[model samples]
Target chain A: MKRLTLALMVLMLSACVSVEYVTPYDPVIDNGIREYKESINTLAKNLGDQAGTEAGTYEANLAHYNALESKIDLLIERANLQSAGRGCRLAEGISAQLAKVAPEPMIQTEEGDSYGCTERLLVLVKDQLDLLQNIHQSADKCNAMASPRGTKISCLRATTSKAAMKITNQSINAVWVVETAKKNGDNG
Target chain B: MSVNFEQVLANILDSAASAFGDGWDSIKTYAPAEFKKISSQIVEIAENVAKYQLNDNEGYSAQTGKLLLQMQRNATEGVLVAVSTLTLIAVQNAINAIFASLRETFNDALGAIL
Candidate 1:
C-alpha cells in the first residue's frame, strides 16, 4: 500500500509539470485542485443553507461561477505571460467565453463522488466546463501559452495560443471530473 | 474500578503507534498518561468504525469531526497532560497529540456503545 502511494506520488509529481487532466500522475493542477474543492464545498454549503428557488439557487451558484472567473488571476504569476504576448489575449478569450455560462439545473448526475448538493450545482459546473473546453481549443491553436517561465519569446506568439490551450484543457478536465465526481467516483 | 478500558486503550495504542509515527516514543515520556490516553482513543475510534459502519454509516461519519473538535475544545486540560514534560518540535506535534487522543476517545465511546 505504501509502495502504491509512493509510486502514485512520484507519478503525480512528474505529470503535474506535464499538464494532462487524467494523468493519474498529476494531482489536479495543484492550486487548481485546492481552489476547486474549496469552491465545491462553498457551493454546497450555500445550497444547503439557502432556500429552494431560482433566485436563491442563482445567488449560491453565482458564488462558484465567480470563483471560476477569478482563476485568470493565476496567469499573472506565470512569467511566460509577459514575453509570449498571448497572455492578454488568453485572458480576454477566457473572460469572453466564460461570460456566457449561467447556473442551470442538472438533469441527472453520474459524478464520481457524492452529489453533495442539488442538481443545480452540477449543471453550473458542466456549463462552465463546456465553455472552458472551447477556450482551450481556441488557445491550443496558437501555442503561445506553452513557454517555460522567464522566456523572452516563445514558440507561440499569441497569449491564448495552443500552449495556453493545453492549460485550458487541463483546467476543464479537472473541473469536469469534480463536477461529475459522483459519476466517476461510483460508476467510473 | 475495572481495568478493561485501559487495556482496550493499550491495544489501540499499539495500533495507533503505526499512525503516530516514530516520534511517539519520545512523546510518550513527556506525557505518558495523555499518550496512553490518546492511543486508547485511536483504538476506540477504530473499534467504532467497525460497529458504526455495520449499523449506520452516517452516525459513524458524524463522530469523525467530533473526536477532533472535542479535543480542541478541551485543549488546555488534555494538552497539559499530553505534553507534561516533552520538548515540542513543532505546533503539529501538539496537533498530532490531539489527533491521537481524540481517536482513542472516539474508539472508547464507540466501543462501549457497540
Candidate 2:
C-alpha cells in the first residue's frame, strides 16, 4: 500500500514539472520587432519627404532615393518575419523540453536565455537607424542649400549620392543580422 | 576664359583639401583605429575630388558629386564599425567638420563664379 502511494506521488510531481516547463513566456521578441519596424517606417517617411523636395530639380537623384526607401521597407518586412519565426522557435523549444521531460530548468530563466541573440539583433537594427538619421540630417542640410538664386546643386547631388550608398550598406548589414539569427536559431 | 576657370576650380579644390588635411591631422591621433582607417579614406576621396577638371567637361558637377557621395559613405561606414558610443560620436564630429570645410570651399567657388 505504501509503495503504491509513493509511485502516485512521484508521477504527480513529474506531471507538474512538465507543465511548468511547457508554459510559454511572454514574447519579448515581438515587442523588439515592433519597435524596429516603427523606426524603419519613420526613416522611410523622412526619406520620402526629402525625395519629394528633390524631385523638382533633381529627378535622377530622386529616383535613387526612392529606391533606397523601397529597400528599407523590404528589410523591415524581412526582419519582422525572421524575428517572429525566432520567437516561435523559442516557444517550440519550451514545448519540446516539456515533452522530453528534461530535468533542466525551463528554457527561459530569470536572466533571459534568449537575450544574447536578441540583443545582437537589436544592436544591428539600432545601427541601421543611426545611419538613417544621419542621412536625414544630410538631406535636411541639402534642402537648406536649395535657395532659388544660388542653389548649391553640387552639394545636393553629393548629399543624395552619399545617402544612397549609406542606405545600401545598412541594408546589407540588416540582411546579415537576420541571416545570422536564423542560423543560430537553427543550430540551437 | 577656360584656363582661368580651370585654375580657379583647381585652387578651390586644393585649398579645401589642405584645410581638410589639417583638420584630420589634428584629430587623427586621438581617434580610434577604425576611425583612422576612415580618415585615410577621406583623404583619398579629397584627393580624387581635387583631381577632377571642373572646367573641362559638362559632367564636372556630376563627377565631384560622386566623390562627395563616396566621402559620406566612408563616414557612415566608420560610424557603423565603431566599437563604442564615444567613438561613434567622435567619428561623426570629425566627418561633420570635414564636410563643413568642404562646403565652405564650394561656397567660395560659387561666389567666384557668380
Best-performing candidate as measured by lDDT: 2
**Roughly what TM-score does model 2 have, to 2 decimal places?**
0.28
What is the fnat of model 2 with respect to the true interface contacts?
0.00
The C-alpha local distance difference test score for the whole of candidate 1 amounts to 0.33
Evaluated against the true chain A, what TM-score does chain A of model 2 have?
A: 0.35
> In angstroms, how far off is A174's CA in candidate 2?
6.4
Q: lDDT of each structure? A: 0.33, 0.38
Model 1 chain B poorest ten-residue lDDT run: B80-89
Measured with DockQ on alpha carbons, how good is candidate 1?
A: 0.01
Candidate 1 local lDDT, B29-61, one digit each (tens) = 434454455444444435544554566421232
DockQ of each: 0.01, 0.01
List where candidate 2 sits over 4 angstroms from the true fold: A1-57, A60-64, A74-171, A174-182, A185-188, B1-40, B53-114
Docking class of 1: incorrect
lDDT of 1 by residue, A112-188 (tens): 21112211222233333334333322211111223453322111112112222232233333333332432332232
Per residue, candidate 2 scores C-alpha lDDT tens digits across A1-188 of 75566555444443432111111222344444544455445445444455425442343344544554454455444444444433211233222422333244323333332322233333444444444434443432333334574443322333343434344344343334333333333343
